[model samples]
Target: MHGLFRFLALSAALMLGFSALASAEPRVRVETTLGSFVIELNPQRAPLTVASFLEYVKAGHYTNTVFHRVIGNFVVQGGGYDTSYVEKPTRSGIPNESGNGLSNRRGTVGLARTGEAHSGTAQFYVNLVDNAALDPQPSRWGYTVFGQVVEGMNVVDDIGAVATGNVGPFDRDAPLQPIIIKRVEVLQ
Candidate 1:
């Protein structure tokens, strides 16, 4: 009877541990000169987005990249530039996973792409408002929404509220003072 009780206790403990680990959403600590924001990535819903982001995280690709664009009502974009504002030639683009049922809402993170449907590289963005139009709908191609800010919505809002300018040739939502992603650390 004692052995059975011990076995049950062990089983219960193991179950609880596994549950915590599985439900404990993995967060990415984005350290910037401005501040640090720990953003959680949801792999269960956004597998491709989470996998792509983890790939970059493992390779340390986001270090020193600038948050190039910041539209107040849209998103604060990043993971594409150096300290001098020269953009990096990113890894080959990933496919559009926008059909994954996630919506682009305030504090949610998603990939940044060109006009092409599958042109998203290392660059990503954080929506400042509930951009429902950007979300996947029956008639439109949507930007993939992978994760939301588990913490640090304030930092995202601060980044969204920064002054922006067209530095050289690019216009529209360019940050006057560049915000650098100093590093990204994954915490599971």
Candidate 2:
């Protein structure tokens, strides 16, 4: 009878310990001067994007990056520079995994890209609305969207609502007042 009681107690202790450890895992949080936004990464579809982004997160690459572009009713982009407009050196490009069937819907996060495959570095964008046109197509390349803004869409909205102007010879739309990404955390 004493042995049984001892076994039960040990089992209970182990379960509780595991639960505590799981709960204590650090969740990634991106706190901008504008507001705080949280994201839960998806490693399934956009593995490369997830790996690279998480690598940067672990290394604190996004600590002082700025949201270089903002287009109200469209998208807000960041993870490229500081308030001084100094660009950070990014990791090697990841393959265009936009073939993963995810759409660039509102609140969704996608890697920024140029016209070439494997061109996405650290730059990313948060969808302002359902930008379905950015979705993957069989005939053409698309941006890889590996996660969504699980929390703090209000912060994203706030950034999107900021007034934009051209900077550093950028003729279209950039933030006149550089909005900085103060920090990014990976939530457990």
Candidate 3:
């Protein structure tokens, strides 16, 4: 019965492997004034970005933050400003993970940054459409897409449709009426 033992061992190992794969991805629920949406992060593709994001979620850093930038047919960005349009202090920037094979497509969540290649911090954006321009090229770094919206994309779309202008400190593209992020919670 050596062959039978080998078969049972292989089946048990395969089951464990599948379970590990399923649990590797972590989900977070983002509660906002408009509504809530769930995002599933790809740690396998973006380890540093995912870890940093989870740390922010566990620290309640996203509570009361406003989706400061909303570009129709483009992206909705937030997680770095409060209702008053004040910038929230963030930890040092993380490395650019743009080459991780994730694309800045519609419903995908990406880490926002400045002109610097590795300047991504606490702020993030949700793509409203397939933003191929945001993807990395052979010469330059692109935005790091670490997660995607798994539910309530309608809420994201509604947020995208808000009226935006020069509100608060932002010169433009700031929502006239703040779309506040109530909180972000990590799903067990």
Which one is best on lDDT? 3
C-alpha lDDT values of all predictions: 0.85, 0.85, 0.96
TM-score of each: 0.92, 0.85, 0.91
| Predicted candidate 2, C-alpha RMSD | 3.2
Worst 10 residues of 2 by lDDT: 20-29
RMSD for each of the candidates: 1.6, 3.2, 2.5
Candidate 3 local lDDT, 1-188, one digit each (tens): 99999999999999999998787689999999999999999999999999999999999999999999999999999999988888999999999999999999999999999999999999999999999999999999999999999999999999999999999899899999889999999987
What's model 1's lDDT at 51? 89
lDDT of 2 by residue, 110-146 (tens): 9998888779988889999999888877687878888
| Candidate 3 lDDT score at position 186 | 93
Q: Kindly report the root-mean-square deviation of model 1 from the true structure over all alpha carbons.
A: 1.6
Q: Where does candidate 1 clash, by residue pair?
A: none
The residue-by-residue lDDT of candidate 1 on 120-184, one tens digit each, is: 87888999999988876787678988888877888888998999878644586778877888999
